[model samples]
Target: MSEATADVRDAQLAERKRVAAATVDTHRDALIALSHRIHENPELGFEEHQASAWAAEYLQNEGFAVELGVGKLPTAFRAELRTGPAGGPTIAILAEYDALAGLGHACGHNVICTSALGAAVAAARALDGLPARIVCIGTPAEETGGGKIILIENGLFDDVDAAMMVHPGTEHLMVRGALACITLTVRFHGKSAHAAGAPERGVNALDALVTMYNSIGLLRQHVKDDVRIHGIFTKAGDAPNVVPHLTEAVYYVRARSHTYVREVLEKVVACADAGARATGCTMEYRTDRMYRERRNNHAMAALYQQNLESFGEHASQPPTHGGVGSSDIGNVSLVCPTIHPYVAMAPLGTAGHSPEFREAARGEAGDRALVLAAKCMAMTVVDLAADPSRLAAAKAEFAAAQQAEAAE
Candidate 1:
């Protein structure tokens, strides 16, 4: 409050930063090795058994109470270092280790998980003056399934004062938009028949699927500018001479807000229904949990940007073009004061979810970005720990954001 208190706080923050930097410096090699190991052994969402075990063990060796298989997710883990008893300020360092389906680590989740681990370990060492609980959450299935959504439903972030994580990307970005998404699989069933002899008896399931796909393509133009609709044929007729009894397609509907996504999704599903009705076939559809859009906390994001600037690498505004994708972290940001910023790991134009991005995820640039991200995150943790009021401001912002969403 007073100048003397401000001076004391500044001195404490400086000391914390020095210790935090030193801690990350001491474990640089190990962190990189961990990141590369995870990259090499890529696993899909909800199936990161080895990666989760390795991360939990690393935090365990650091003296954090490790618990694997939390929130009904087999690969999810919660490791914590507590300074005192209950009711202490709790900060969460999120770790995402799941890789893409074909492109291993294309999104650089290995870097994300290790950066969180490094920050947790580094910040835990400098809690002498600032007493708080530092938690490292091993969240799986960010690439496919919504593991963070599952964890949140199970109260994974009940005590979290704030949450933060850094993702490696083509540019250093302070904050970016993540669209709300719905992924679904639609299947059409029909009666099969011999194409050459009795084709008239066939229901033509493949025709139904093709019609639905085309209808979706046409529906995209009618949706809003921010809406995105895409689908791929996962299954079709098996043989040319035999009519298809079953055909399947997977579709993804995305928009900037969950409400808008639902609205667009209704029309998208109607297209499929029309295809089925026209083809005299029955359609069945299934979807996983919906991913909400990110609610970036301005106060916390500003703090993270300041910390990143401390490393001599300035973070710039997010790209104006290049429509944003989706992530499970969006779900977390909706519930907590969170920041999912980015540090550069690849070149200026490397496209994510591609082979080039996958290769660059394990290169020298990724390693350097990993260390810088950890340091920045650790410093930001110190900022929140030394001055709890900042975290309070972040929470205030989060509450207001939630209120605005509720009103909408």
Candidate 2:
């Protein structure tokens, strides 16, 4: 538009950003308390009743209409804030609060969920009287179950124009993506007999499992550089004297693309088949939940980075080839323009999902990162709500990426 109009819009956008940042600062203590509470509790996927309740309650107190148990998920919730009319874009701020099985908050989901909550509230406060909609979605089960995938299936993300969330990591990264992944459970059955006394009468199932493991090791050499096939022996027989009649293993097959990961999974199953045939054992396998590779919206990520760097905290470039994990948020990215940027909470080279990471998530550095992430995200929301063209650009980028994938 005209220069005067452009200047007016820019002034409004800057004011909205300032208000959003101030709102986050106004509730800094409460927001940090919420994060620490969730970190202390450490609920697992789909079982985060307390965490979900706490998040919903916090949003409700801020004048948002809160709904829990959406999509038939007990721990999932949705908190909505409407600024004026209903025709504006519905921006979703996703929250992930599930903890690891034994590690407890090692994945730093407490930071993820709380930052999202803070951003949503602050953005709503800043965008008051503006024609926009802000939604804070509490998506459980990112660590195990595909909670976001299930929400998508239930049409939770059908109307969302865009989504965003921040994750805690060892370094700040604006554009990192995850691998497509699926888990496989394999079982081999045979006859059992005394190993020392009647070894000839027994069909060794353990031997079959060992053979399949070795075959997978060989197959890894032939796969793509980004493909990863890994497994663990779940059932390797009870005792040494007794010939193992049944053996089981769980394998995770991952790749940069969903189709490629499935192809690799089939190869893994073939390896199991060969092992069963060579050892005279019968083999059966099944697949678990699949996670799509993340489609990071570069346009949206760039906006987020601009806001993040405005705080004087720089971000590192993500690896070009590998060094990534899978998440249910990838499924959300497929549904809407999404950004899952990272904020550093620990020293560089620190491994995630470990005791070190878990401690850092609850330490002083983590607290600072949590608040900074909230302000960055809140400012980004201000950017999108203040300028419609920015959101359109992000959606265009996402649409083009989807078209490219479909062509392949």
Model 1 TM-score?
0.96
lDDT string for model 2 (1-408, tens) is 999999999899889888988998988889889889999998889999999999999999999999999999999999999977767889999999999988999988888888888899999988888889999999989989999999999999998999999999988999886999999999999899999999999999999999999999999889998898888999999899999999999999999999999899988999999889999999999998799999999999999989888888898989886679999888899989999999999899899999999999888877888889999999998888878999999999999999999999
lDDT of 1: 0.89
Please identify model 1 stretches exceeding 4 Å from their true place: none
Q: After superposition, how far is residue 38 of candidate 1 from its true place, in Å?
A: 1.9
Per-residue lDDT of candidate 1, residues 1-408 (tens digit): 899989998897888888998999999999999999999999999999999999999999999999999999989999999755555578999999999887789988999999999999998887754578999999989877899999999999998889999999888888899899999889999989999899999998999998888888888778889888887899898999999999999989999999999998888788889889999999999887999998888898898888777778878777775559998889999888999999988888789888888888888888888898998898888888768788889989999888988898
- List where candidate 2 sits over 4 angstroms from the true fold: none
Per-structure clash totals for the candidates: 0, 0
